[model samples]
Target: MDIATGAGLLAGLTVVVTIILMGGDLKAFYDTHALIVIGGGCLASTLIRFPFVAIVHGLPLGLKFAFTMRSTTSRDLVDELARLAEVARKQGPVGLEKVDTDDAFLAKGIRYVADGYDMDFIRDNLERDRDNFLMHLDEGQKIYRAIGDCAPAFGMIGTLIGMVQMFSNMSDPSKLGPFMAVALLATLYGALVANLFCLPIADKLHVKLADEETNRTLIIDGILMIRDSKSPTLVREMLLAYLPEKHRHEEGEPVPA
Candidate 1:
């Protein structure tokens, strides 16, 4: 689980709730109009920017990221590749066919190798596919950023509308404060959603992309090394080089084996 994502979101919500309760009138803050203004506006804007399917699919992923954890770690990926490398060395590339079919991303390269595809062909195809995958992710993040940008502006608009309505009733000066509160509240809610939700998800997606790239590259190198029947120690060393500098080690060193 991604503790950082979970902790950050929980802390943010805790602070918001604490502040709202301290305001002494929780019901006043829970305005239906405010909900319509902020939630409705954000959703409408997001829908306009992204496809219906994307929005639907992303909703659960977004909530999961916000409330829990959803990211792969470098060590987990490195370990998986290392294991695959060992398997390929023992039984040749054809051995990986079973594992490949299960994971779409890994399956592509593994299948290419099992089919006796040339090294250049496998590398070119995997690299092209990886680039396309990364580009698709980038586009998705851009959509989320666009939605984040729209949410706050509409929030400000909601505040202005509320304030105008409040000022129209000059006889009831008491409404002035509430109207101002609505205005400020909308802006707060908008900014919160943008900063705490949309942008953060985009950032998380970016991180995931980087980690996947590393994993894919490691697999590419490992596959090539196995195809050439390189020594096990040398193949392990080459794959290990793709990892972060801190993870690489001397030939005889203990590696949690």
Candidate 2:
């Protein structure tokens, strides 16, 4: 779980409860209707905004964004590249054909090497993939941001409707507080949905994009470095520049060599 999200939720709930218990009339709130409008509105709007297939495909990606931080580092990527280089240098590109190609970033390079593609084409194509992946991430983040912006606006709309209903029967002043609370609830729900859910997801997706870009750029550098027949030691050292200083010295350590 995201510590920031967890802490913010706990703190917000505590404040809300304390405020309500101190003198705020608990009965005047319109949380249920707020729930219906925000929940139903967000669902309907998101469905309309994205294709059903894309939305379904994106469900788990979004959930992953919510729960997981991208953790693969430059050192890990450099190590894989160095190993690939060792194999290619020993037996030529044909040797790589037998290697697993499950990782998308690594698979692209392996596929290029396996297919006997020229070094220039291989580098250009893999660079294109990196660009496209980053573009996809940016586009995805925008969708979540749109939803975040809409949630609050819909909340305000719901509040207006509630006010209209309350004022229609305004002959009794006793209904004023109830209607006011209901109106306020719309803003609260909108702010909560935007802040707690949509915005956080967008932010997380951004972080993923940044980390992924770093890794893919490392892949690009490694691929080109290997294609140029740069020494494995040199390739490893260059890649380590992308990592934190702590991982640098390990680049030269022998693995029983």
Among these predictions, the greatest TM-score belongs to 1
lDDT of 2: 0.77
Per-candidate clash tally: 0, 0
lDDT of 1 by residue, 43-65 (tens): 78877777877666565554444
Error of 1 at 134 (Å): 2.4
TM-score quality measure for candidate 1:
0.76
Name every residue pair that clashes in candidate 1: none
The CA lDDT of each predicted structure is 0.71, 0.77
List pairs with backbone clashes in candidate 2. Answer: none
Model 1, residue 234: distance off in Å is 3.1
Give the alpha carbon lDDT tens digit for every residue of 1-257 in model 2.
Answer: 55665676678767777887798676655467777778888888888888776565565555566565444556778888888888778877788788774467887787787778888898889889898767666666766777898899889987997799798879988887667766789888899778877787788888878878888988888877777777788888888888766666575675432
How much is the lDDT of residue 171 in candidate 1? 87
